[model samples]
Target: YVAPNDSFSRGVKYRIDTDKMEIEQLWQYGKERGKEFYSPYICNVTYYNEGHYLTHSGGIAYDSEGNASTELGPFAKLEDPNTVLKSITVETVNDEVALELEVNSNFYRANKFTLYAKEEGMSDLELGQGQLLGTLGETNQMDTEIPAEETGEIVSDWHEAHLTEEVDMLTFQAKFEPGTLAMLVLEGEEETRQYFISTSKGLRGAMCTGTFLPEDDRDTRTVVTKDGLDGEYKVKLIVNDKKFETGLSIRA
Candidate 1:
């Protein structure tokens, strides 16, 4: 019922509790003010004992036609602001190669993130020493639908509805390049045995899960793990396959 309105001759209604030292209000305008006026938006403020206050706020503003205009506050930041996958551990668990990782989106969108592995003793990473282990896909879009009547400017009826949507799992395959590491890298286009692992569910904030593999697996080289489908962000890569060989480590 309460709204922010600078159009009304009497000005918009506002509430301010003396003890609270803060005022919060919402305004609605009966008529749009020519493109000069900005659309409604949310704002925050912190009072400094003095009459003045330091305020920080942000939101999308629109013109008279309700078209998005300039954005306000910190929301204008350009960076996509990605999440961090922490506590990543890849080990042979039972018959399967288990990948356990933790990620914090910090309330941003993150798509399918994957893990990769490669043979050891390969000095050149670009020479193809890695393969996909698994994928963890995530989404933030809700499945809620908008009603026709409520969509129009004039309201008819109002009712709350639950969102019904599905999130897909991250997927990846395992294909160890078998040669002396040098041969596999030079060949480039060899059809290795690739294994497919299905993602079990969606992830938000963080995810911790493991996949199974055959016990006969012998991928012992300090394998290289990649993030996402493109295999970017090398997780772990060693210089040599044998313990006696010198160790060259690169982590992403």
Candidate 2:
């Protein structure tokens, strides 16, 4: 979960200076203080008052011999028998530890919320309510030209593909072979778009959410946003050198 240039983990607090137009560091954790205060992934800090704060170090991982592991813990735990997961939460007041908690598990982040309003005791409406609308980004292009041999064949029956539309994206789910070159092509009236599908992932730095992770490693849940798309289009697929029609069409 760590980048090469930004190894290790830490929490920092900054104070903005309105007049000087500069920021000053109020306090920090997990710097030269060593590995005891470090977590490679899944940790956070919560601020309450001027001098009180809560911090969570939720991704401490260790190997069989109890040595710190460079590999991410969640996947390592599933693969290795001796992988250990640890989570720690601490509260500080006036830069001094006031409360501490430790757990034998992993969490992405620790959050503290108030349940009732100050006066009317109205419930917090936003609790347990959330939605995510992802933005569209650039798509990768195929290296070679589109194959000419269509075979007039539809997608293979074993592929088991299902397309679902959302607010601004369409998700295509299908099973594919690992390390295979697969592409999803959308042929529109005025334009055509080709997007690559990842058949396999080598290493995972983190698994913050499993919404799109398939139970089978070879299964892929590819999402294509409708940001730049319009009109109607026929859906097609390319597996290796074979091009196949999907008998699918969409209006964006």
Error of 1 at 146 (Å): 43
Clashes of each: 11, 0
Q: Model 1 residue 206 lDDT?
A: 21
Q: How far in Å is the alpha carbon of 58 misplaced in model 2?
A: 3.1
Error of 1 at 221 (Å): 24
Error of 1 at 61 (Å): 5.6
Which pairs of residues have clashing backbones in candidate 2?
none
The sequence of per-residue lDDT tens digits that candidate 1 reaches over residues 1-252 is: 223233211113357878989887533221233222222233233332333232221222333344433332122222111211111122222323233222321111212223444456543346556665654432222133211111212211121111121122222222233332210110012211111112222222221111112222322211222222232111111111311111111222
lDDT of 1: 0.24
> Any runs in candidate 1 off by more than 4 Å, and if so which?
1-42, 61-66, 69-248
Q: Give the backbone clash total of model 1.
A: 11
Relative to the unseen true structure, what is the Cα RMSD of model 1? 25.6
TM-score of 1: 0.19
Give the alpha-carbon lDDT of every model: 0.24, 0.75
